[model samples]
Structures are given as C-alpha cells and as structure tokens.
Target: MTDDYILVLYYSRHGATAEMARHIARGVEMHGVEARLRTVPAVSADCEALSDSIPAQGAPYASLDDLKNCAGLALGSPTRFGNMAAPLKYFLDGTSNLWLTGSLVGKPAGVFTSTASLHGGQESTLLSMLLPLLHHGMLVAGLPYSESALVETHGGGTPYGASHHAGADGKRALDEHEITLCRALGQRLATIALKLGNDRGPNR
Candidate 1:
C-alpha cells in the first residue's frame, strides 16, 4: 500500500550477509519496485543491555511498519548452527502484532544466508528462516534450476534460496554464482509481489 516496496531485512555479523542484501535490493529495484534495506541489532546476554536506537553504520534498524507495508520481503542472515541469527529471530519474534492482523498474508518472501564453512548448513539456515514467513501466510519464492547459477555455483547458490560460503575466516566474498542467485531470488520475489498486488486491485 505504500507505493509497492520490497523489504530487504537482514542481520550481518561479518558483513557477508549485508553484501548479499545489497545485491538482492538491486534485483528488487530492477522490477521497478522500491527496496527498503533494514537490519536488526545484536542481542546481548546482559539483562540491561541495549543497542543504540540507530546503528553505527549500514542500514537502520527495522520497524514493524516496514514489515506490515512491504509488498514483498527478502530476509538474509549469517548461519548460526543451521539456524538464522538471534538478532533477526528476535526482531521477527516481535512481529506477532502483524501476524495477528494478518498484515503480511499473501505477500511474497524469500530467504538467503551466509555460512563460515562450505558444509555449515546454508540450506538448513535458509529453510529455518522460511518457517516464520510461512506462519505469516507469506507465499515463499525460491530460486529454480532455471537460474543456471544454481547448477554452476561452486561457492554458494541453492534451490532453497541464495547463499554464500564465507570461508573459515569469513573474508570470502560472494562469487559470481552466489551473486547471480541473490539477484534472481530478489527479482522473482519482486515480480511475484507485483502480480499479487495487481490482483488485489486498488479497491481491495
């Protein structure tokens, strides 16, 4: 309803996931939809711990309004033992209001992740991220084999969604295939979101 935008929400520790978010945002824009980039703060063990209202750098923190108004969603995170990072999970846990309102129902969503090791559960992480979207009644979109990169990627790319292998030191950049798949996923979600929005019509 806010002029057709896709929300690229993510939590990045070593910056790999942030880079992936950027590529995905580019793909969303390619479909003539605005891409809103946002990130969540890291969780702290201290009961009194709290992050600044604004992040020191990179994208600002996300709000429930961003999620509720998004025509589509692209979620990214660094893999944590085959699950999404706690920061992202924490933010999502707070979206129960949206869930209760069914604000995100029927929206398009996609997931992506970065792992430190090649076998460090990239696909599992992507799948785990999809669970909440499904609960929100989102229509999930994944990269198909037609993306070519899903077959050609030596580093990272998957039918589940886009992914990247950041290596043990976490310095590795996204390869051509990973980048390609990220964009492909974003484009697919954006295109689908547009079609769904059109179907809803101005009066609906």
Candidate 2:
C-alpha cells in the first residue's frame, strides 16, 4: 500500500479559505506526511449547471479516489448562512459511495471555514461539514486548549477548527492566531493519522 498522506480539500470563493488550506497543509507536512491539496469546482444556478473539467486556477478538482485513498482529511469552505457553501456540500453529497463501501472508515478528519464577518457562523459552518464525515465513520478531530492561539484569536480560530474573519470586503488576511491554529489542526491530524496508520500495518 502507498504511504500516508493528508488530503487538504476545500472550496474557496474569495480565496481566504484556500489560504487557510495551504497553512493546514504546511502543518501536515511538518509532521512528516505528504499533504495533497485539492479543490472542488463551483456550481452554476442555471437549470443545467456545469463547471469546467479542470479548475482555471488554484488546486485541481478532487475525485472520490482522492477521498477513498487519503490517510486523513481536512475539509474547508466559506460560510453561507451558518452552513457550508453549496459547492462544497454538493461535492460531499457525492461521497455516499465511499460511505457505503466504508473506504473512509476509521480515518481522521477535520473541518475549517472562513466567514465574511466575525459572527457570520464560522463555527457552525465547520460543525455542519463534520456531520457527513461522522456518518462515514471517520474519526473527527478538533483543536484543543493546548493550542495557545485558540485563546488569543480575536479574528477566527476556534475549537471546532481553523477559521478566518474575511471582513465585508473579503480582503482581510488571517491573523496570527488563525494561522497558528490552522497549522496546529493540520499537525494534530497528521500525527493521529501516522499513529493509526502504523497500527494498521501495510495491509491497511
């Protein structure tokens, strides 16, 4: 079997969430595991919705194979009315096959999000994304008090996962605490995946 790798998957509309994904990937790599960054395409409102086969920029489109093969997962998105955006949700809804096959069972998973405002539902959105992973029987991970950034963050880091206050203009960058937490979440997940992977042996 292939070695361990953490899949950092996300859908970024204004880029903040994508940046957070990068930070999380950095954290994963710091723990000596490969970080695979992937993103989903946007959906159109037209009755016949479609997206390009390859994304114009940023990470390439993710496939079910990526999800099934990943050693761990870090899902990210922007908040939409206290829920994950539809594009991310749409991509996840297609993972039922992985769920049915139990391909993702026992893997470690985490969630992150960015919001236009401080009170714009960052935590709730992260929680919403975790539900599907839970149903897939993945081990859910969240930031803990050991991460000092959680207490210092005025912008977005939370126990649920890393988040960013993108502001109304969507131009504000992630603060130091947000960055620290993002990395912490990535490291935490990778560490867990490594331990679990070692226990499962080469057959897994």
Candidate 3:
C-alpha cells in the first residue's frame, strides 16, 4: 500500500500563497509524514479554451483523487476580498463527489492564506477556506496558544491558521514567526492524522 500523505493544495496568483504552501509542506514532511504539493490552474472567462494538462512549473495540477485519498489536508490561497481565489474555489466545487462518498470524513484539515496588507483578510480567507472542509466532515485544525510564534508574531501568525503579510506590493517574504506558525500547523495536522489513522486501522 502507498504511504499516507497530507495534501498541500492551493491556488496562487502572485506566488505569495504558493510560497506559504511550500513552507507548510516542509513542516508536514518534517513530521515523518509525506506531503503532496499540488496546484490548480487559473480559471478562464472563456470556457471554450482549456488550460494545459500540466502546469508550466512548480507542483502538478491536483486531481480529485488526490484530495480524496489524502491522510490529511492543508489548503492555502491568496486573499481575494476576504475569500479564497476563484480557481481554488472552482477546484473545490468539483469535490462534491468526494463529499457524497464521505471520503474526507474525520480527516484533519487546515487552511492558510497570504495577503497584500496586514488587515487584508488573512484570517477571514482562512476561515472561508475551512467551510468546505467542514462540510466534508473533516476535523478542522487550528494553531494553538502553545505555539510561541503565535504569541510573538507581529506579521502574520494567528491561532486561526498560518498566514503571511505579502505587503502592498506582494513583495514581503514570510517573517520568522509566520514561518514557525506554518511549520507548527503542518506538524499538528500530521500528528492528528497519524493518530486518526492508528485509531481507524486497515479496516477503515
């Protein structure tokens, strides 16, 4: 059987959220769990045209099977007016089949976001992203007070989830506290997933 993996799925327009996804994946792998990084294609106004099957660079496009099969999930997106980007939402909308199958029930899930301003809806975006996962019956995970980075962060660490302040020009890199929170979120999700897996066993 294939080893269990956490799905690190995201859609990034300006690359800030993609960078955060990388850090989250790094944290996931550090916890002795596999992290499968995947991205969604940009949506086009013209439905007649199709996107390339493979992305130009970075992680490959995510398949529904990927989400359904994951041991856990860490979703990320750049803020789009207090919500997830259209492409990410579009991809998620297709997962209704998985929802019907109850494929993600009881799995641990987390959300992350990157915003252009400190008040540009990072927490709101993260919360919005969690809605679908909650509907799928996944156990939503959040960063806890025990994570020192959450207490010390001046940039983007929050108890809600990992976040980054990309600044007005979207040029600011993730701060140290932001990075720490990203890792903490990943490790926490992986640890919860492992425990759930043990509890369920092969019969599940």
Candidate 4:
C-alpha cells in the first residue's frame, strides 16, 4: 500500500484556485499527513493536441497511480459556466480503471473552487466536482457550520466546500475568511482519512 497522503489536485487559470490548494495542503500537513499536490494539463480543441511529459512549472501532472494510492482527495477548479473545467473533467473521465478496481471507495474527498464573481456559480461548481468522487464511492466531506468562516465570510466561503471570489479581473486575493475555510476543509478531510485509515489497518 502507498503511504498515507491526501491528494490535493487542481487546475488553476488565474492562480486563485492554486493558492487555495496550497492552503489546503498546509492544513492536511498540520493534521500529521502528507499532501501530494498534482495538476492536470489544459485540454485543447485540436483532437491530437498533446502536452509535454512534465509541466513547465507548478505541481507535477497527476497519474492514475497517484489517484489510486491516495488516502483522501481535495479537488479544486476555476468555475467554467457553473461547472468544473474541461481539463479536470477530462482527467476524471479517464479514471475508469481506478473505478473498475474500486480503488477510491471509502476514501474521504472534498472540493474547492474560485470564481470571478460572488454569485458566479461557486456552489454549482463544487457540486459538479463532487459527482465523480461520489461515483467512485468516496466519502464526501464538506465544510461545516462549525467553521465560523462559512457564516462570516463576505468574500467567498461555502458549506459545499471552500471557495474564493477572485474579482472581475481575477486578481482579488483570498480574504481571511476564505483562507480559514479552505484550511478547515483540508483539516477535516485529513482527520477523517486518518481515522478511516486507522480503522482499516495499515495495509489499506
């Protein structure tokens, strides 16, 4: 079995979602677990388009092994018309092998997102990301009301998951509340993953 680690996987266009991923990773580590950060390459209109073997910068491209071995997952995306971006959707679409093997069953998972506006479908985007995780039989984790940021955030924070309002130009940094909620979600997932791992034994 792979070492205990929560996979922090995401695609960021304007950098907000990536930043949120970083914060979430920190929270995961704070709970005494490793956080493996990975990302998917953007898709293109060309049917034969291909990216280089490795990304130019940022996190490494995720492989099926990464997903198969993770103890938990944190999925993030920049909202595209109230949905996850095509690249992430495309990556999940290719995980049929893992699903067929029941690799992700019972693992905890969470979602996060960033949008250009306060009402730019953050909840819908979060819900859309959760669909595949649910299909894989993963336990879905969401930010609870106990995280005060969910109730107090003026910028972006949701019970559905962590979120940030990136502003019209996509430059607004994550506000304090948003950051707190992001970390809270990550910590929650990690804690649950650890408990589940303990219950299942080291070989799981």
Candidate 5:
C-alpha cells in the first residue's frame, strides 16, 4: 500500500471501463504521481465476493487499504441502467469503516464510465459513481469546459466526468475525444491531489 498514489478503481464487464481506467492512470502519471490501478471481484447472487482472492486478469482486486490510503481516486464503471455496476457499488458499501474514521476526507476524486449506447446514461452513471466518494468526504472534481474535447466529442465526454459511448454491441473502441477526457479527468485528480498533499498528512 502506498500513500503517494492515486487509486484508479473501477469495474468493467466488456472492458470499456477498464480501458478508460488505463487512460486515466496514464494521465495521473503525466502529472508526476503514481497511479494504482485496482478492481473489485464480481459478486455472487447474494452479493458475496466471488471465490477468487484475486482477479485472473486486468487489475488485481482492490483492498480497503487501497481506498483508505490513496492520495486521490479515480472511480470508473460500466453503466448499469444509468448507475454504477453492482460490483463497484458492493465494494463501496464496504467502506463504512473508512467513513467512520474519516480516512478519505479531503482527498480528491473523479469518475469515469462506459455505456452501450450514445444515450445510455453516461452522465447519470458518472454522477451515480460520485455519490460514494462524496459520502466518504472526498473532494470530487469534474472536467472543466477548458478541455476542448468536451465540446468536440461525438462519442462520450461530459463535464460531469469522463465517459465512453461503447456501441450497442459493446465493441466500440474509445474515440480520441473520449480518451482525451479520460486522461483529463486523471490529470485533474492528480493535480489536485498534489496541491492538497501538503495541507493534509497521510491518512494511513
């Protein structure tokens, strides 16, 4: 566990959200910070953690320490009918312990998402993901209009957060505009995290 990193946390079914997370991580590094990419395991019908101690591919399963000790966070997920996917939500629900101790207070955070259609609740999903960070007392930030990709995007990009409009079949590769915004979101979080670092000591 590291206290000097931004945690890039997300859940992806068709890989779009995971792809976005990678881009965000790149942006975080661009801002001269380490980015810890992490994911949650899928849950069973009763919401129990799936048997594996770690995921077979992509990022490893995120520990509570990942969330608790992060300097900042970038949460991403595939859209679940205008909300975050259940796996991501399930992981957040376990953070009540961190909330009680205010471990996440004053940390900067951002969100990103992928949707199956152009109107498939991208903004809503982004907003939905932010709710948990807000409750954790994180200082959540969204992309500012200063980023030109927000105005030129035909794919998925929102002032609310970074997003990708995966085609209905879920095969649409991220367009340049969507990629830009994802990196922008990551950069924003990293920048804010560094500025806030001096004012706040390590929560861990």
Candidate 6:
C-alpha cells in the first residue's frame, strides 16, 4: 500500500538520459503502476550557487519523500568518466537518513544511463548507480538475455540496465532497440514493484 508508484529519478546533462527516463516511465505505466519522474538540480562549482525552486523546464526536483515512499525505483544518469554524474550522486548521498530507517528496504530498483561515446562506460555507470541502491537494501532488478533488444542492440542495451549512445556530439537519438530496452526496464521494474506490495516484507 505504499503509493502504487515507481519513482524514476535521474540527472540528464544533454537530454539523452531524460529521454530514456520518459521511455521507462511509459513501460512502468504499461504495467499499471504510476511512474513519478523527478530530477535533481545541477551541481555548481560555486558553493553558494542556487537554482530556482521551480526549474525552467523538465521534471520537478525530487524530495526525500519521493524516494522514501515509492513502491519501486528507476535511477538514471549520464556517464561521468565511467561513473554516475555528480548531481545524481549528490542527491543519493543525502539519502543516508532513509537508509538508516530501512525506508527503501525490500523495494525493487533498476538503473539506466546515457553516454556520449560508444563503449563510454554505460555498464559501469549503471553499476555505479546500483551501489547506493544496494546499500539501501533494495532488491536489484536487471534486464536478462530474454530481452531480445539487449542482444540485438548495437547502440546501447545491456543485461545490467538500459542505456543509450549519444555519440561524440551528444546528439544521437536513442535508436529503436534502446527505446525498447528502456521501456522493458520500466515494465520489468513495475511488474516487480506491484508484486512486492508496500515493503511489508515476507508474509512470515
């Protein structure tokens, strides 16, 4: 009974990751679960720099309550030198409070990422996002070989998570395979989340 929703939280620098999030949300809704899309503000070099309470465009900034109450999670980020982007990491780092309270324990979670180059650490970036979720005691769900797009995709798709290659110019749109995988990931996570039912834990 925790809200019947999966929180799709992410940070996109060049829009590729945001597009992936949209596809994933569609998949989540396909499974009859609400997909709550939220994003983090960009990190700034100036310590005092601040963004408007409402962003100029795109999803609203995520609050701790968003992650805490979700039935599931789909975390996405752009690759930052084989890791998750700083903005997403910064947001996750603040969730220690939730971790201590077991807020996310027993929830289903998955990761996705977009990269500017082929072989630019899509898998590594996805794995990097997974670490924090693991620490939160959430159940990690990943795409399997059963997803044909994973094998057929020359651009971006993986067993770990959905991904996209934005090319060196950061403008390549997600191909059909990548979009399929993204939707598949969302659908898979939503399916698991519905079956999970509010973190009440096993019937015991």
Cα lDDT of model 4 overall? 0.91
| Backbone clash total, candidate 2 | 0
Residue runs of model 5 more than 4 Å from their true location after superposition:
1-3, 202-204
Q: Indicate the worst ten consecutive residues by lDDT in candidate 3.
A: 195-204
lDDT of 4 by residue, 165-202 (tens): 99999999988999899899889999999889655443
lDDT of 3 by residue, 46-118 (tens): 7622568898899999999899888999999999999998889999989999988888888899999999999
Q: What's every prediction's RMSD, in angstroms?
A: 1.8, 1.7, 1.8, 1.8, 1.7, 2.1
Select the stronger candidate by lDDT from 1 and 6.
Answer: 6
List the candidates' TM-scores in order: 0.95, 0.95, 0.94, 0.95, 0.95, 0.95
lDDT of candidate 1 over 30-112, digit per residue (tens): 88889999999888766322678898899999999888878889999999999999889889899999888888888889999
In model 6, the runs with Cα more than 4 Å from the true position are 48-50, 198-204
Residues 1-204 of candidate 6 have per-residue lDDT tens digits of 435689999998889999999999999998888999999988877752267777899999999999988888999999999999988998998999998888888888999999988999999999999999999988899999999888899999989999999999899999999999999999999888777664445310
List per-prediction Cα lDDT, in the order shown: 0.90, 0.90, 0.89, 0.91, 0.90, 0.90
TM-score of 4: 0.95
Of 1 and 4, which scores higher on lDDT?
4
* Tens-digit per-residue lDDT, 84-123, candidate 5: 9988998899999999999999999999999988999989
Best by lDDT: 4
Candidate 2 per-residue C-alpha lDDT over 1-204 given as tens digits, one digit per residue, 9 for 90 to 100: 147689999999989999999999999999889999999888868632366788778899999898888899999999999999988898998988887888888889999999998999988899999999999988999999988889888999889888999999999988888999999999999999988965543324
In candidate 4, the residue pairs with backbone N, CA or C atoms under 3 Å apart (3 or more residues apart, or in different chains) clash, namely none
Clashing pairs in 1: none
